[model samples]
Target: MPSPYTVIEIFMTQYRCKRERNARKKFSNVF
Candidate 1:
């Protein structure tokens, strides 16, 4: 099994990627 910190890190990375994707979509829409 993975450690708690490792799991949290994975979750954070996924969340960051999602946020970046949304930001990119919004930026493209504005242009």
Candidate 2:
């Protein structure tokens, strides 16, 4: 059984993780 909310949750989590990683790299370079 598949749920629509599950897919959205996974996608959002991946997007957030990617954004966080990029931000970390940007701040690290600045520091």
Candidate 3:
């Protein structure tokens, strides 16, 4: 089984990916 830390790390990476996508979308609208 995976450790707790590993699960948290995965979740964080996904969250950052989503944030980056949103930022890009907002930027495109401005430009």
Best by lDDT: 1
Candidate 3 Cα misplacement greater than 4 A, ranges: none
lDDT of 1 by residue, 1-31 (tens): 9999999999999999999999999999999
lDDT of 1: 1.00
Can you give the lDDT of residue 18 in candidate 2?
Answer: 100
Residue 20 of candidate 1: its Cα lDDT?
Answer: 100
State TM-scores per candidate.
0.96, 0.87, 0.91
Q: Taking the tens digit of each residue's C-alpha lDDT, what string does model 2 give over 7-29?
A: 99999999999999999999999
lDDT of 3: 0.99
Backbone clash numbers for all candidates listed? 0, 0, 0
Q: Model 3, 1-31: lDDT tens per residue? A: 8999999999999999999999999999999
True-structure Cα RMSD, model 3: 0.5
Error of 2 at 10 (Å): 0.3
Error of 2 at 24 (Å): 0.1
Selected candidate, larger lDDT, 1 vs 3 = 1
